[model samples]
Target: MPDRHVTRSGDDYAEALSQLLPQGQAWPRDEGSTLMRVVRGLSQIWGVVEASASKLLEVESDPRITLDLLPDWERNWGLPDPYYQEPLTIGDRQKALVQRMTIEGAQSREFFIGVAAQIGYTITITEYRPFMVGLDRCGDNRVYGDGTNLMYSDTFVRGWLPVYDPQGNPVALDEISEWPNYGLGPDTNRHYWTVHVGTSRLTWFRCGGGGGQTGVDPHLRIGLATDLECLLNRWKPAHTQIIFDYSGLTNGGSMAGTP
Candidate 1:
């Protein structure tokens, strides 16, 4: 026997179903037969039902594939976090959802490292403590004052999102990029932390930077910003300050499925 016809027109279904009648009804097989016409009409309704059922299973819950459902998903997930005052691109919205679903909160180094891995980053978190003479071991490298590293400015101009490199050089930063943190003022060094994400993704233009390709678009530069600062900031312990270190990127890395 063959597989039953699945999504056919009413006429096809009528023909198949009509055959289920006993052979004694064969005398009514003509087009004028009311019983045959009634079955055909009913099959039209069945055909509509078949068409609906056939397509329903193809629907998806994946945020990227279901663009229209993003608002619903985000709403239910309580997303578009208050930190994101600037409008997000389609790509960012997708990233936000993936981040939300994959993030599991904790204050440990392993927890943050795992969260960063899910969104195309490999990170190492460093916790800080104000250096105390007897409490800290020699060469433990703890700081006495702020121990502040030149990192991304938490204060962005006009509240736009900017990815900060916490371990960046002080010389490279302009006045606007400088974080107005108090130096030699407070003893809250224990609340500060840094994440070294292993190298910058930025590609600056230079005469010999390209591998002999000349026609490449200069404006189409790869950006270093991952918008990761916002995600980490929102989830980090309320008392801790975060610094993203991008000045020490290493070689030979792939971002896909990094966990």
Candidate 2:
């Protein structure tokens, strides 16, 4: 037998309901057909319910919260205001110094090395002034601490010189005043070792001229070695990364789900 097809419309549903009821009676008749009227009423009710649900979601997800709404004591409960937090500790200050120094490039390397020395650590020098080992006769004839003639007056100096005894054994120089031409030599062979003791004091050493002339040995100097080792142990450079989330909660409540 061939399959029979049925149309699916509001009238078809009404007719089907009518057939289910007693033969003489029909579904409650009304204007614009009972089925359409019921469907329209349900749609209107659903619209009101949907609007109410959307309003509830809006209330829950609201993100407007200000400190003025709460008492002073209550404001400290969650996230404390950055301005009102405790002052940074020494470690924090040191870390900040390292971060800033790293950004300043070569000029700040001495400062970094000083800090590392204090902490009992050392860093390899990748770049430095080529004529750092010589006198005031490199690229610019003017030398550091030579009044106002130097081009890069801000740069630090590190040089070495040898001391020779009139006899045979090497000996330290009695006084710096003995050498009038010290630091004024045009050749790289006449420089002397100088150790900086803190920012203000510099101690110059005139070693016995015997072995190959070289840079100052930081470890051999008692004062410099002790100070630098102390600093290295005190402020070892292990920096920690920090991240902050600026997105705050809604009216002091838990974070709300998406609407």
Candidate 3:
């Protein structure tokens, strides 16, 4: 037997309609001409609409297109990617800075200070350092140095001792000189014997001068707690702000207040 074809085209629809007509009957050449034109026009219009809808659906389904899913503050506000161009205005730079800092969990001093206070430590903003960048650089051309000098300085915290053992009796300097320094180099030899007390320091910096201008340099530095546990325990959410309430959809009530 001949194989049966499952798919049909527009010609197949015409042939099937011909079979439905009476014997020797036929449609006029111009029959339903206006209706055909209307349908053809409608098909063309629908094609454009369908293509646009498909593009929108494609964008909506993509996980990387997250602007629509973000809150107003977190969204890009239709701005182009800041990394692609040098921010010319203060607002543009601020937006870029906030976006980056939010991602880094260093958005504000409050966040760092709050976390530090929780762990019996205090943060102090104490020093500033400035550096020069060439004119060809991009973005905020002038970047301030973080207060690493103070953080690494021995005078910042004094309770810590530079002895090998805090509880043991003090050893003579002559005795320490005779003892084997092991694998420690001369620069780190003194540090090898130090006992770290419950004191640490963190330094943070802000980018300060830009706008396509020359000779405009600014500087600022801030301190943060360097306690490993406190720093690690800081409030660093994956999202900078809340935009959705998933609980309302799944639990039949808003989860606005309850922790």
Candidate 4:
């Protein structure tokens, strides 16, 4: 067991006094005695220093539970960026701080996948490239910039968000809601890419879950991964166009996110 740092009390002092001297009859060590009263008074004063030292030594050390030193840490790291709006929770602040401190800067697809995992989503990235002749397979349905056989994610407005059930209760669906890969086009279109996430977030309601009826858990539904999309937009390269998509169907099939 860990040691208690409360320091010596009157009982401890009295016991030590008896041990240090020859077997004593005068030192009855009773609480009512004058000698015992003096010992108790001294223990209180001594306890103040011990308690202070104990608290000092225990100063919040881990960032996971770090409360007292959070402000100092945030200021030093130049955090609370405009990318994230206010009314943020302490857990959110801590996560951003730790991410800022440890994440490696990269523009790779795998890197973005790792970033999604940090925010509680498992996702896949699709990179587009301009089509070519001879080098490309015949009848491969490559884009010629005419818009045929090519699809792109225009997520200018995400209308598929499940903010309410059919009954209009405030709720989010629990589903895959993943989008299909935005087909590539012209050379400039190569900058357009897509991320397909595998899960959606939903808060448990007292009445049950997000399903409008039957009280079904909807564990296999494909909903939205809003946070993953937001974070990716904030970090994607200046030249790249990111398309966030999730399956609209519960069968794990892709949805045509474009108009």
Candidate 5:
């Protein structure tokens, strides 16, 4: 006998479409490959829509009504947060500093578009990058060999950030780390999380009065990590550990230090 494929239901078809197009982007952006992936994903969605139409006609259902099966913020259903902010190229550090400070309390949506218009705009501006990337959590079970809990984060260095002055230049200031899981190193099995939210120069540098600016210091890392641990520990299921990988944006460097 030949193998047979089963048809899918409206809900099942939607789930399949989601798994195929998980996240907003497709991998490996080659021209031909990207086209194929998009076509496949679109076809799957169309199938779901067609099946839904058939079901509606059979039952004479109200098309205006919508059904939400998942939780309010489930990974599959919730809208992914926009990460890009307007990019502004400045002549020097001081002007950058002023522009960076201008976006202090701007909400994510009105920012860069409406608010920026209200205020005079000049310096080069690019949309903000993703605030977070590759945020994940792990679990632990003695018998299951998964006895680990961790959180990790990474951010851009001098990347197009939200803060700016009236002149639209980027400030040389740093971000106060507000990641949920702050501190707890890898060795410990109790609880830990690491967050990277600072800027750095790609190559090495030296100042007459100061020391080298290569490695991350203890004070800043500990402060953020500690706060994260405290926040997670409050829950009944305490988080164990987190590892942040900021190397991608920072050119393999840490920004948690006094410059």
Candidate 6:
């Protein structure tokens, strides 16, 4: 009932345990509470607290691994499309794009097209310049081959997390604060997250865009980006993977219950 009483009771129990321990027992032998166990407990709590968070934060493993299936792609399926491609060259460039999915059936008719719409999208650009190279290293007085190889990336992610009000209206529906961050390089920068309302899912895209060289602040173009994300969400009309990438052990170890 009263929070103070509950807290006091917990404290008293802790005190009793403290007294029962020998003069200095090394704090419960935390070797029994290794980092792996902590991760297991965290994973469990995450599942309990979010309930549905598991779909996005799941882990899997397989003993039959092979060279053909070395790097997994299934985990980051919800990530933005551009990240899947090769790293952008210093001078090379590509147009930025966004898309959205609008739900229209009876159950999703209201929120999907209404309040949930208020949450905006984000577009971000990151220009990882080359370290620099000397003239001879530039190439054997080579033909205009690609300039210094650099890690140029751009990303678009949801700036504000989405939420819908009781009256069926989107509160903060149109803002892309920063670029979505998946990972880097080939499997370098890959990250993704999702918000779910029943069976319908709002997937945000993220990746390095090739626009960093030009000094563009993607958030300023939120209006255009929102339009694109909305389109991607609504009518792609294609079968697509819903998860990004997967990593972890399959056998389900016992050390997953520590913290």
Residues 105-220, candidate 6: write the lDDT tens digits.
33223343342333332211122222123311232211221222321222121232322221212323331122222222333122222222211122222224222223432221
Kindly provide the TM-score of model 1 when superposed on the true structure, using C-alpha atoms.
0.50
lDDT: the better of candidates 2 and 4: 4
Q: What are the lDDT scores of the predictions, listed in order?
A: 0.56, 0.31, 0.31, 0.52, 0.30, 0.27
Give Cα distance to truth, residue 152, candidate 5, Å. 19
Arranged by lDDT, best first: 1, 4, 2, 3, 5, 6
Give lDDT tens digits, candidate 1, residues 85-111.
444444446667877876668888777
lDDT of model 5 at residue 129? 22
Query: What stretches of model 6 exceed 4 Å from their correct place?
Result: 1-75, 82-107, 114-118, 121-219, 225-259
RMSD of each: 13.3, 26.5, 22.2, 13.3, 27.0, 25.3
The best candidate in terms of lDDT:
1
lDDT of 3 at 119: 33
Candidates in descending TM-score order: 4, 1, 3, 6, 2, 5
Q: lDDT for model 4, please.
A: 0.52
lDDT of 5 by residue, 123-240 (tens): 1222222222244233210011122222122232323323332222333333222222222343343333332322222212332212232343222221122222222222212333
TM-score of 4: 0.51
Local error of candidate 2 at residue 34 (angstroms): 51
| lDDT of prediction 5 | 0.30
Give model 3's TM-score versus the native structure. Answer: 0.22
The deviation in Å at residue 31 for candidate 2 is 55
Worst 10 residues of 3 by lDDT: 250-259
Model 5 scores a TM of 0.15
lDDT digits (tens) for residues 1-259 of candidate 2: 3223332444445444544554432545454766546754544554565555554444222212111222232333332224322322222223333433343333233764655443333332222122435533434332223222212222223333332221111333331111213333344323222222222111223233211113532212222233333333333333311111112212221111111
Superposed by TM-score, candidate 3 places the C-alpha of residue 243 at a distance from the truth, in angstroms, of: 27
Candidate 3, residue 138: Cα displacement in angstroms equals: 42
Winner of 5 and 6 under lDDT: 5
Write down the TM-score for model 2: 0.16
